[model samples]
Target chain A: MGAVIYDRVALIGLGLIAGSMGLRMRADGLAGEVVGHARTARTREVALQRGLVDRVCDTAAEAVEGADLVVLCVPVGAMDAVAREIAPHLASGATVSDVGSVKRDVITAVGPHLPDGVHFVPAHPIAGTEHSGPESGFPELFEGRWCLLTPLSDGPEVERLARLWNALGSHVDVMEPDHHDLVLAVTSHAPHLIAYTMVGVADDLRRVTDSEVIKYSAAGFRDFTRIAASDPVMWRDVFLNNKDATLEILGRFTEELFALQRAIRTGDGKMLEDYFTRTRAIRRGILDAGQDVDVPDFGRAVLRKGTAG
Target chain B: MGAVIYDRVALIGLGLIAGSMGLRMRADGLAGEVVGHARTARTREVALQRGLVDRVCDTAAEAVEGADLVVLCVPVGAMDAVAREIAPHLASGATVSDVGSVKRDVITAVGPHLPDGVHFVPAHPIAGTEHSGPESGFPELFEGRWCLLTPLSDGPEVERLARLWNALGSHVDVMEPDHHDLVLAVTSHAPHLIAYTMVGVADDLRRVTDSEVIKYSAAGFRDFTRIAASDPVMWRDVFLNNKDATLEILGRFTEELFALQRAIRTGDGKMLEDYFTRTRAIRRGILDAGQDVDVPDFGRAVLRKGTAG
Candidate 1:
């Protein structure tokens, strides 16, 4: 148990991020009270049923009222409307933050709508599963994950929020909004779009039946499916909001793909081998950094057996 | 334990597939003796030390001597030379098979080298981890995985090999060589190429530091790195040997990617959302088929914790 960082923390959207935050905060006594609101009534009901929040409010405006810290956890595209809805209701001196993947677009969308006294700290916790919804969240969802904060201004509020994230088992790093978007573009947005595209291509291939793709997916395609299965609306908003950076990365990806494809066509084994060998080093770096599990097959075979009778 | 399927099984190349096959066969008493041969002395030493083989032969010819089943587990490009080297040494009634990823190429490369009485059954077990080498294998590696056989002729040898795969814990399927190549191109080869290309692009980007990419990979890019981390020589050979089919799939993938990119550029939220929604069904299909574990984040979070303490 940790000391309460905020007397009241309101989460504007009851999806995975909000649900996880509520659960972690409540579990560790990081906040005195956790309030949550969702556009859909069912989400709110589930959020309450799952103990993701101490109180479920009917509206975003109602959720933010009297809250010491307000978090906007909706899709990037919905940030502006939620910001507008909560701005007038936010308590004076309250620190406002977000769990949006793209920072620049979120800042552009939510900054102007905030009241002068309210602190807006745009943040992206670089952690989540393909699963979404309130029920999909767990208290340990953000454990050992990186929480990137792109603050408009540094103050006690930002430090307090960082403390909350730290208590929730995240390492906090501050980055500029533009750099955050570009970094996420390379790490998350572009990879997701490419995965979605490849999975879509596999599904659309008439010769390869869906069952075959599903059955033989363990041969590398399954990884893409897991990634492509992430919340569609959230990913769509990310791509749209971070359009330029995502496209730029994709363009480079295509150019590289063409070069590799040409090597395959021309039977240039050396070039293909060299390129592949280079990428292996990066995977090693990620594992050494503890960003991923070092277990073979991501330990899926073990997981499968563990779930079996 | 199951009855011995073969009097003696010889595994050439002694890499991931061969090592796993050796381990399973020995563990289950499926083969009377599991002998292995690797191109490198270090791999042979590791195979012996790891108990991946009962005996590590210095040369392919010595390993295949008197073996009832000789499995070519080498890279696609090395299939021809290995086949030629072992052709004269193969027993008169021995069954010769392979664990190659691309079927048609293996069939083309290995077909003519076999003796008249030798049974040529080219098999591809669609199972692996990103980790390779002799030490990476486990007895349970093939549990519930699919092993596709592209045989040149139908006989008792083919049925016996299928039974061996089934005993090793894989569902056996038979398909034409060309069709198998195309299906794998869509499911494995092309996806791997795409993952490799994306990782290469991320590494090449001057704006995103390698450290930032590694730290933030859990957002999505880490999955691609796992795929990209696969054995370079094997993947390079896969691309080279399955050129036509892989290139065709890559072409389709690029077209689909461009359409999605345009949607992002033009703010076609509906199209983006719809496409993403459709891809989600494939993931569901994979889970429903039991090809992938339904656990969130592939249960990586749990695995990480398990390893920690």
Candidate 2:
């Protein structure tokens, strides 16, 4: 494997992904200089203190100066503003990619802001932790994880950018941005939404179930609580950016859910058993495929059922 | 705490719960002798080999001999046969209790078999793990957990037995049999069914998404997988026995899910965020209440999340 990818790489937004990028780039000798940008002075200070970046710039435009590669690692809602700010200063022939969860919105938000000479690439690494901030990231977050690239054409710049992620210890996959959104909606967004809903239901169960909630959570509901504990702001933007695809999957999910509810009401054990049995196999598939990144909590937000002071 | 709640303890069904009962009884010195009975020859052998019981009996009748406490830890479907098998040999004044997840059916199945002098207490310890076998038990399984006792006021031995679980590291709450079912339906059964359905949906996804299902499962779906990966036969029995309560909760769950699904379909970010925020508080409640046991797998399955291999 190539020990290094970029001589001078810029990481904008010193949150989980950005910090993780800097850590991995440095740990694997993947970059010589990792310059980072953050709007908040405290976060920038903390990012530097945590050794997440080699250089902390005052602005995104300043961070991208003289950079060969720039990875946009910000919330989807902020993509547009950041893109416009950095576009004017991006070096010619530089490759700009992102690490946003929602792809289509990033493309729409950042595409027009790219300068004529700057090469644009959008990527979503299928990796993260529930904990957010520079302090929470580690060097191995991207190791053996999938970093998806949604390139626009057969440009050598795009392929080279894809190869860069591969060098950073990621399995690179290229797909259409819309398809990426659809797939994620089905696999990720919808599940998180349902988890949020389940946690809400448990919360609304009044005081009686309240006392029993945590004690007996081992029965099943604790899983939802873990997922629902995820960062609220990041998720809010994700839902906002990927509304249509999420809605489509949510519709299908509700339809299936209602049918199962009907089966339960009607005492259809066969149906219930069939559904439960089928799901068990899927869990096996995940275990067999080795997709879970050896993390017991699976990067879930499990503050209570997970970990917290 | 009373070290010996009963002079002798008989455990029917040598699975996780039965083994756990023996381990706990021995660890806490809660029993004079622990006798385990299982119909399967191999289970009996395993129980003996693992020291799950002071003595492994060939029959329920032999197991219940000289016992003041008899805990039915068998599946709900097998309750009656075991109850009847032991009824003929149950010592006079002995208190009979159960650790089944569902109470109503257990009352129906084991109630008729109870001798006039034997007390029948239906108890549900709101805790469990995915693993099921003689060796898949631990002494601390019931520590600080909630155990619901469906009391028959007419029975003295049952009330005495209910007090035993309270002393055995469980916070005991007594309620009518039917009422207990309703509470559990919301707290445990419905959540489990939903988890099962979601996992099934993921399993039924296209080959492409299926391949990435476990890979990106850490994002959310892996939690569902963990819950869905519970013992199939035990879960099957829970739904089958607790049909009324499970169905009622299922109705409410679907109604709530529908409202959320509609909001998602219409691109209502406020509704999603509102629900998500509301749920985060419940997890806090569970923690503040001291219910989030810091054991393996949220106190259900062994949680080896990021645990060193």
lDDT by residue (B1-309, candidate 1, tens digit) is 999999999999888899999998988999999999999999999999999999999999999999999999998989999999999999999999999998887888999989898999999998998888888888888889899998877899999999999999999999889988888898899989988988898888735464788887765788888899999999999989999999999999999999999999999999999999999989988888888888877787899889853
Q: Which ten residues in a row have the lowest lDDT in candidate 1 chain A?
A: A206-215
C-alpha lDDT of candidate 2 relative to the true structure: 0.77
Predicted structure with the largest DockQ when compared to the true one: 1
Model 1, C-alpha of A244: deviation from truth (Å):
1.0
Candidate 2 lDDT by residue in tens digits, B1-309? 356877899999998888877887777777888998998999999988888888988888998998988999988878888888889898888888898888888998999989898778788887676667787777667667788888777566655666667766788777788867777776678878877777766666656564766655645776677678777777878888887778777776777877877775676778877877787776676666666533222322222334422
CAPRI-style grade of the A/B interface in model 1: high
Tens-digit lDDT track of model 1 for A31-139? 9999999999999999999999999999999999999999999999999999988888889999999999999999999999998888988889999999898889888
User: Where's the lowest-lDDT run of ten residues in candidate 2 chain A?
Assistant: A293-302
Q: What share of the true interface contacts does each candidate keep?
A: 0.83, 0.55
Candidate 2, residues A33-76, lDDT tens digits: the string is 89999989999999989888988999999999999899999888
Q: Model 1, residue B283: displacement in angstroms?
A: 0.5
What residue pairs are clashing in model 2?
A296-B305, A296-B306, B297-B303
CAPRI accuracy category, model 2:
acceptable
